[model samples]
Target: MTNAPLILVVEDDVQISRVLQTSLEGAGYRVAWAATLGAAIGEARSRQPDLVLLDLGLPDGDGLSLIPQLREFSVAPIVVLSARGREEDKIRALDLGADDFVAKPFSIGEVQARIRAGLRRQRQATYAEPIFRFGNLRVDLEGRSLRRNDEEIHLTPTEFKLLLTLIEHRGKAMTQRFLLNAVWGPQSLDQAQYLRVYMAQLRRKIEADPARPRYLKTETGVGYRFVPED
Candidate 1:
């Protein structure tokens, strides 16, 4: 299906690449595989994949290098697949702008879920939708207003700014530093506690259950991610 989203799979291992290709195709996506960093960059540039499934370990070089390269031309989400489960590794990838990370020995279902979320976010970004809705919660980006279950909810200017920042980078796992800089400015980089306070305030107004937020999720040891549902 030419209309299907193209997913570039950058993995050297034949087995993993084959599996991902098969599963992604079966999930209604156009799949392209590149076994090395060089080929991956070429494919990304030429085909302009809707999303990228990248392996951290490549034959030519570390896959981490490809993140900025691909970012230069495309906004396609990059989901890293690696055996390195260390917190540092994940922090590095997310900091580098990798959309999401999957530890090796991952299930097809999990990967597909990540892909779906990434693509959904990508679509939102592409269209620049004026309004965002998740369940009964509705955000009017143009109007700068939010509503829950037909009732208009109020958010302070700071809270609204923070929420807007998260919505702009909807699907990607945003590091605390990134959010801080985007919403508060570079000077507030060290004030992580500001995020914690505002996030809690936001959850109270947007989430049906602030205790178990469905949209604003915490990526422990990293930061937060806003998962906007359909």
Candidate 2:
């Protein structure tokens, strides 16, 4: 149906692609498949999928390279399914604008959940409501203020800007360099320590338990992700 979300599966393995297509279609998503990087790009351009499931290993070229190119034309959420589980590879993919990453030998249920979450986050970004809510926390974009259970919590201008940047890309793994450049400008791209300092400051104010944050989560070596809870 035209109303169903279109999912592009860019995978070279025939069996894997078939499994994904069947599973996704059963989950109410319309599926499109591409076995190579070139065909992937062509299908993406023609179909303009609502989301993409990319495999880093492709016959023609590395699928990681397709991320930036896809970003050029579409804001559709990209969930990378790859066997390369190295920390650096994940960091590179996220830095290149991937929405999420799942390793090979992945669960069908997990992949479906990731797709649902990615699609939900994409819709949120598209609509971009001025007010964001998760549990007791609230962020008012237009008002530029944060509140917890209706109690106004003050944040410094810089801290607010940092938080705002994270909120804008909710559910995505944002690299430190990306956050730094966005908030502090390109000149401060190397100042990752600033994020550490300010993030602590933010947690102190917003988090019920600063030691274990519910919203602003660290992605180990990657960066930060703003997780929204219903």
Candidate 3:
């Protein structure tokens, strides 16, 4: 009936698909399944399911290639099913507007938990205006402004996005590739320099000492993270 939520499952692995379908059905969901991006898009567009279970490895297309395209129609929470499982991949998916992800060979319990989290997020549209504070620096997203010890600061669009991305996952390391892809595009996956430039610019504006940034710290070969002072 209409009381049950519909879930669109996209996976190329037949057994995985079957297992997820069975588990999801067992958990009381109306299920729709697809094995490729084309079919996934068609079903997602037409069905407008309450949520999406998207597989990264499709025989017909790359899952990353389909995300932006899918965003055109469905605002349903997309939980990426990927084998990459790297921290970078997780950050990238999250930054690209995915609600969550489950790596390959995952436990059904974990997937169900993530699904619950994502759906919970989707339902809670009204959030308390978060005022992020790290030492002397503060950002009020609802107010759309930054402050340092009561002094307001200006931020460009790109700078704001970069700052927002870092702040969203404070203390978590995010790769240059992930940042570049999220803000720039998939074409920027190879352009680490862009990330370096933006990080430097952000530090200059937000940090007390850009040369020795405390909040926006880099992880040598990996990426950057925003660390809030306790």
Candidate 4:
């Protein structure tokens, strides 16, 4: 229903957006770009691209602020591209309505993979509708958001991907190694502490009951699982 599977690349930096445009087009995707939040919103309203590559630093407003608004109007997946290196920064963006994200200075391969994942999710959403719910937690796959007790819950980039991978896999128990590799990368597989920190953080937000989680079940010496309470 979109025009050429169009993708919107929104970055205040002209060079970055241009480079992304070229890269995406070269890979056979049509792209529209905007250098400001206002312009980006306009592009979304008029063009309605299939996917969006958003940068955290926009000229008019915080890129995160625009996400919930955009989600209200479109089903297009938004993949955030940010240079912010802090764990909190990534979490904040994900908690907004972004579907996926990569820290800036990201490689082309990563971006490509991210785009593929987003499109794949878009397609999957069309056919099989899966809503993750456990206690007060709920994930709207199509809308790319989370709600706690009917109220929205915000997550960051790392947190969002972490949660998605676990919930997507559901009962299929994964390991710390698998979680690290899937969300962080192969190189971070050895950084086991990262998993601990993130898992703890996710519990605080998703657990009604962070003290003892019911849905995000952990497999000590292994990984975690998302088994919705029956």
Candidates 3 and 4 compared: the better one by lDDT is: 3
Summing lDDT over every window of 10 consecutive residues in candidate 2, give the lowest-scoring window: 221-230
Instruction: Give the per-residue lDDT digits (tens) of candidate 3, residues 155-190.
Output: 988888888877665544466777787788899888
Question: What is the C-alpha local distance difference test score of candidate 4?
Answer: 0.78
Give lDDT tens digits, candidate 1, residues 1-230: 98999999999999998999999999899999999999998999999999999999998999999999988998889999999988788888987889999999999999999999999887777789798888788889989999987899999999999999999888788899889999999999999999999999999888778999998999998899887762
C-alpha local distance difference test of each model: 0.91, 0.90, 0.79, 0.78
Question: How far out, in Å, is residue 74 in model 2?
Answer: 1.1
Candidate 4, residues 1-230, lDDT tens digits: the string is 23457999889888887788888888889989888888888999999889999998887888988899899999888888999867566555655657666888998888977787677656655666667665767787667688977688888879989888876655434566678988999999789999999999988987777878877787544456565542
Model 2 global lDDT (CA atoms, 0 to 1): 0.90
Error of 4 at 94 (Å): 1.0
- Clashing pairs in model 2, backbone N/Cα/C closer than 3 A: none
- Candidate 1 residues lying further than 4 Å off, grouped into runs, are none
Estimated TM-score per prediction? 0.94, 0.96, 0.58, 0.58
lDDT, ranked from best to worst: 1, 2, 3, 4
Where does candidate 4 have its weakest 10-residue lDDT segment? 221-230
Write out the backbone clash pairs for model 3: none
**Runs with alpha carbons beyond 4 Å of true place in candidate 3:** 126-230
Model 4: residues with Cα > 4 Å off, grouped in runs: 1-3, 129-230
lDDT of 2 by residue, 73-178 (tens): 9999999999998988988898898989898899999999889989988888778989888878888999999999868999999999998888888888788888
